[model samples]
Target: MTVKLRVTQLAQLEMAALGGIGLLLLAAFFFQLVQGELPCAFCNLIRVCFMLLGSGLLLNRIYGINPWNYVLSGIGALIGSMLSLLFMFAKALPTTKPTGSAILGLHMYTWTFMIFTAALFFCLVMATLYAQRDSLESPGHALDARPTWHKGVIALFVALVFANLVSAFLQNGFDHFMAGGQQHYRMLYDGDVMKP
Candidate 1:
């Protein structure tokens, strides 16, 4: 094939890959919401990065006919990758009784981990796209690109993640894991409730 045709093919593939990343991120968000778990600080940061990269790739798919489309995608991918690395390093550290959505650590939300992984995965995909991006709109014939396997992967990831969350909550409830939180303390510890 001609050099121009080859470049176009690569671009299409990159776009499909970006789409895969977006779907994965979306799946993670859906899982978190359906599970009723709230995102903590770190989680929110990760979400922002994912949104940035995801939006960037999406814009490329939309207005990618322009050369600047690749530039936008590159910037978004770089930012997303940097943010992902920061959060991953901080979170990978041992858990420390994290309070209320700290940026350093995540909460007990299952989506916390899932979203982190999702963002990182998307960032990686975007970086690869930057390395390969040439024509922008898509690599090849968008209609022929089958992403069935990608969907399967995302479904499995989210289901198992959310299932784990439900299991943990159930175990905690059954075992009164919040016993410490349930403790009753008096302002004046005279004897019992108060001194006579």
Candidate 2:
């Protein structure tokens, strides 16, 4: 027999998925800090999309599940997948060098494309399934009823969002535009002078 999930169970699954995205963001930071592999403009765009997806998930967990939440995340994934494809295409060019190191024989953009595509598919599936079920968009599914783990996932995503904001400013400085293949943070200084 096919096991159908309750609305609460679906909400919990969304929380878990958001937590996984948080881990991915952390890994990106690790690469930037530990490996010194800075993200290109395209990479930053993909990261932004992840943030958008997380924001939608956050809204649902806080205000209860709604179709608008899916729309927000689905649009993010759709745009992210497109951006990933363009980045991959750039890497395909003869003179275009690869951005960052490859992981598991695939570039970061390639992996992101797969992830965005998967996320888009997931949103579609989940939205359809959620619509088919009974309308439990009531107080029965309030945030206070959820376990602490749900709040933990929200907290993790929120932290990552702020961390990414700080890191972006550090990388690009006040200009808000990072140079291609930038090696050091523009905001950093050496001795008495800032690196220009």
TM-score against native, each model: 0.44, 0.89
Summarize candidate 2's per-residue lDDT along 25-135 as a digit string, tens digits: 999999999998877677787889999988887887787668898999999999999999988998898898888888999989999999999999988988897788556
Alpha carbon deviation, residue 123, candidate 1 (Å): 9.4
Which window of ten consecutive residues has the lowest lDDT sum in model 1?
Answer: 179-188
Clashes of each: 6, 0
Error of 1 at 71 (Å): 3.4
Clashing pairs in 2: none
The deviation in Å at residue 84 for candidate 2 is 0.7
lDDT of 1 at 44: 43
Candidate 1 per-residue lDDT, tens place, 128-154, comes to 655564543453435324356534543
State the local distance difference test value for candidate 2: 0.82
